[model samples]
Target: MRTLHEAVLDGLPEDLAPAARSQGGGAAMTGPGTTQSAVSRGQQARAGRAGSVRFAAGRALPLFVRGRGSGGVRPAFTADALRALRARHGGAPVLVRGLSGAVLVLLDRQELRQFYEAGPATAPAPALGAVPSRAAVRAVIAEEARHLTAAATLDLVRARHAVARAARRIVLGGGGGGCDGEGGAGEEHPAGLFGRLRRRGAPEGHTPLGRSAAYAGRQGQVLRAMDAVPATLLRTLLLLAAHPAEQDAAAAEAAGSGPAEDLPRLEACVRECLRLYPAVPDLVRVTRTETEWRGVRHPAGTTVLLPAHFHQRDPEHVPAAHVFVPGRWKTPGADEDLRMAPFGHGPGRCPGDRIGLLITTALCAEVLRRRRITATRPVLDPPGPLPVALDPRGIRLTLTRR
Candidate 1:
C-alpha cells in the first residue's frame, strides 16, 4: 500500500508525483504519532520533488515578524529567503507554499523576461495630459521643500505628509480641493468621492449604478498617487542620506536641472532606490490558462510569484547587488533590463510610472538642492554591505542649509 505522503503527492503532476512518492517512504500505520509523522514525511517528499522546494511554516515567520506596520522590512526578509532558496535549488523556478496558497517563484532572469513578455495586454497607462503640468508639479515640490527646510530635522512622518500634499495637488489639481482637509465649503474631496464611488458599486459595466469610467479612473489615479508616491520619496531620501558621494552628485545635478527629466544623476539615484527597495517588492499573478515549465504542467489558476527584490539584487546578474551604484542605471541597456522592474513590466506596468517618477525625482532634487542631509537613526557606511531591509519609519535625517 502507498504511504499517506504518496497519496498526497498523487494529486500533483505526473512529472512531480513520482519523485515525491519515491522519497515518501513506506505506508504509514495508524497510531497517535501517525498524523505528525505523516506530515513530516509528506513535507520531505514535497521537498524532494524536482524543480521545487518546500519550506517549513516556521521559515516564513521572519516575513511576518519583520514585515508588519509602516515600513515593514518584508522585502528584505523575502530577498534573503529567496537567495537561500535559489542557492539550494539552482536557477529553476521553485514552488514555495505561501500564506495564501502554492506560489511558483520565478528565479531565473530569462524566465522573468518571458513571463512579462507573455503577460496579457492591460489598459495603457492613463494619459499624462490629464496630469498637472511639470511646472505645477515643481511648484508643489518647492512649496513642500520650504516646509521641510523650515524644520531642523526631517522624519518619515513629516516626509509623508509633504508628499501627500504634493500628490493631492498634482493629481487632483488646484490644490487638491478638500482632500488635504483645508478646502472651502462645497469642494469635493478624494475621500468623499471615494465613498460615493464605493456606494455606487463596482466599476462601469459591473453594475447599473456603478461608478462611471471617468470617475473610477480619476479615483484610482488619486489613490495610487497618494499611496505610492510617499513610499518612493521616503525610500529615495534614505538612500541618498546613506550614500554621501551619490547624494553630492545628485545634488549637483538638482541644482542645475532644466526639468525633472534633465536631472540624470538625481533620476539615477531615484531609480537605484526603487531597484533597492521597490515599493511593491513582490509581483503575483494568477495563471489564466494552464502553463508549462521545464516539462511540468501547472494547471490554470496557479499562483505565479516574482520576488523582484531578489531578482534585482541577485549577485550573479546584478553587479554590486548589495551596494548602491547609481551609475549602473546610466549604462547602456539598463532601462531595457527586465530584471530591474521597479515599476513593473509589460502590459500590467503601473500606468502612472512617468508621473510618479517625476514627482519623486523632483522632490528628491528639491531637498538635496540646498540642504545637506545626514541619516542619524541608522548609520549606513557606503563601503560596507548595506542592510537587506530598511524601515522608512525608522529613518531620520538632519538637514543643514548649504
Candidate 2:
C-alpha cells in the first residue's frame, strides 16, 4: 500500500499534485463489530488480518461497511449511485455491502493502479492453466465467420450463438460434450490437435490439447470479454453510416489494409466504442491483507470492485465523456489513458488483448469492405450493466452487399 501510494504520488501531473496530496491521506480503518473510534487504526489493522480468515470461513462480520446511501447495489444505468458516492466520500475508498453480506471496497484511478500493480511480494499467485492452441482458436474463429456469412440477417441471437459456439469448441473441442452437434462434416478435422485432445478425454487440469476445466474457464472469460462486441460493433457501423464522409474514409482505409494493419481510423472507431461500453463492466478481486491505499484503509478479505465502466466514462478523466467521437482517440495521451481498462492493465492484464483486438478489427474491416451494414434498432440502449456479462439485447443489423 505504501509503495502504491508513492507510485501514484510520483505519477500525478504537476497541476494535479496538490489535489493528490490532499486526497492521499490514509483511509480510516473500522474494526469488526465495533463502533467507529472505539479502536486505534493499528489495532483495527491487526484485528482485520485475523478477521479476514474468519470472514472467509463465514464466521465473522465484515471489518468494513458500505457507504450509507449506496443501497447494496451500484447502478450502472444512472449516474445517481456514482454521484452519491463521490459527494459523500470524496476520493476516499467507498465500501459497499452486497445483499449476500459481502463487503466490497470501491477504489478510483490512483488507487486502482496500486491494486492492479502490486509487486509480486504482495500479489496473488498465478493460477496454473493452459491456453488453447493457436490453430484450434483460429479454427473456432473461422467456423464463427462461416456462421456469420451464412446467416440471413445478423441479429443478437445469431451473433451471440456464433461467438458462443466458437468459444465452446475452442474450450471443449468440436466433438466434445460442449459442442451443439450443429457442425457439419467439413467442420471437424480428422486428426487435428483438438481432435486428438477430445479422444484422449481431457480430464481436469492436464491436457496438451487445451481441453481442460482451466482452459474452458479461460475460454468462457474470453467470450465474456467479447460480449459487447456485437453491440459495440453495430454502434461503430452506425457511426460510419451516420457520417458518410467517414464511411468513405473507412472504406478506402479498409481496401488498402490487411487484418494485421493498424489503421488509425478503424482503431479510433473501436477505441471510442470501448470507451463508451467496455467489454468488462467491472473487475473484482479480494484483498489478501488489511492495507491502506490512496489514503483509504481497506480491511483484509474485502472484495475490491474496480468499476471500469464508471472509470472509463468518468467526466473528470474523459472530455465529453458521454459523447461518442472517434477522433478523440487521435489526441495525445489518448492511447495511454490510465482511466481506460478495456483489456485491463499491469501484470494481470489479459494475455489475449492483442489477439482479441486483431480479431475484432479484422472482422470489422472485412465486413465493411464487402457490405454496408445498417442497424434495424437502436444499438446504444445499453440494458444496464451486469458485471461480467454483456447486455444481450439491443443490436440487430441488416447487411446490404456492395
Candidate 3:
C-alpha cells in the first residue's frame, strides 16, 4: 500500500504540470497554513472551478442520482459533453479549460485508442497504483458477504463502507481481523501479518502520509467497486429472471460436478453489467509533450479525456451496442468485446479490473446457487447514482431458499 501511495504521489507533480506556466494557475490560496507548494497547480485549477464544473458539467445528473446520490462528478458527462464538443470540433481533439488551463477531450474511439495505446512515455500519467492482492480481494469479498448478511436493511452506502473498511484492514494490517483470521482466512488477526507483508514487498522510505494516502485511495477504489457490485448483482438477477434459458445454463454450471468449472453464463452476465454501468465511466489523460495526433497539432501537456462510456456503447464498434446481450462475449471472433473497457485500457488500466470481475462473479454464483432471486423493480428505470454506482432505487429482491 505504501509503495502504491509513493508511486502515485511521486508521480503527481509530473502528471499535472502544463507545458508552460500561466497566470492565475498557481495553487489556490486557501488562507493561512496552506502553503503554495502543498497543493499542485492542477489541484488549484480543479478546486478553483469546481463549482462551475459541478453545476454545468453535463446532463448525467439524473443518471447519477439514480443510486441514491452515490454517483458524483466522476463521469463528467462524457457522452453529452463531448457530443456537443465533437459536433463543433469534428475529429480533432476538443480542448476544454475549466478551473485548469487546457484539456483536450477525446470523444471518438479511434482518437482514444491512439492515446491509450501510446507508450508509457506518452500515455496519460497514472494517478494511482492500487492493485489489491488476490488474498486481500478474497478477504474483502468474504467480509463484504458477511456484512451484507448481517445488515438489517440493505443500505448501499453502508455496504460500500463495509467493503472499504475491510480493504483498509487488509492493507494496513490493523483494525478488525479480516486478513488475520484462522488458517490465514479473512476473519482473524494472524501473527506477523503486517511484518510478512512489509518484508515481502513494502516500498522503503515511506512518505509522511503514505499509508494514510494509500488507505484513503484504496478505500475509494473499494467503495466504488462495492457501490457498483450491488447494482451489478441486481442487474444480473434481473437479466437472469428475464431470460430463463440463460438462468438455467448458469444454474447448471453452478451445480456442475467439478468445483472449479467455469461458469460462462454467470461471467457473461457480469460482462453485460459492466458494459451498461462501468464504475469509472470516463477516463482522463494528459500529454507530456507537443504532438500531432490525426492531423491535429496538440501542444505539450494537453489533457485528453477518453470517454469510456461513449466508446463502449459505440454502435460502430459493438454490435447491438445499446442492448444487454450477455452471450455476445461467447461468440467467435468477437474482438469487439475487448473494446468494452469499463476499467479503461492499455498500460495504466485499473489493476482491480480482474479482481472486480471475480468478486462480482462469485457473488452472483453464490446467490444463485443458494436462493431464488427476483427483482421487484424495472431494471431499465434506475432511480439514481449512489455516489459512483448506478442504483435502481426501491429495487426490492426477495431471496427464497432453493
lDDT of each: 0.62, 0.50, 0.50
Q: Model 2 over residues 195-302: C-alpha lDDT tens digits?
A: 455455555445544444444444445554454455555556655665566767877797786443466888787777676666555677777788775444667777
| TM-scores for all predictions | 0.74, 0.61, 0.61
Candidate 2 clashes between residue pairs 3 or more apart in a chain or in different chains: 25-295, 26-295, 27-295, 27-296, 27-297, 66-95
> Candidate 2 regions off by >4 Å?
1-78, 102-107, 119-152, 164-178, 181-228, 330-335, 379-392
Q: After superposition, which runs of candidate 3 have C-alpha atoms over 4 Å from their true positions?
A: 1-81, 84-90, 97-101, 119-228, 257-259, 331-338, 379-389, 392-394
Model 1, residue pairs in steric clash: none
RMSD score of candidate 3 (Å): 12.6
On residues 283-322, what C-alpha lDDT tens digit does candidate 3 reach at each position?
A: 6666677876655566776776666766676555667665
Q: Top lDDT: which candidate number?
A: 1
- Model 3 score (lDDT): 0.50
- Model 3 residue 352 distance off true place after TM-score fit, in angstroms: 1.5
Please report the TM-score between candidate 1 and the true structure.
0.74
Error of 2 at 276 (Å): 0.7
Backbone clash numbers for all candidates listed: 0, 6, 22
RMSD of each candidate relative to the true structure: 11.2, 11.5, 12.6
Minimum summed lDDT over a 10-residue window in model 2 is located at 7-16
**Residue range with the least summed lDDT across 10 consecutive positions in model 1:** 7-16
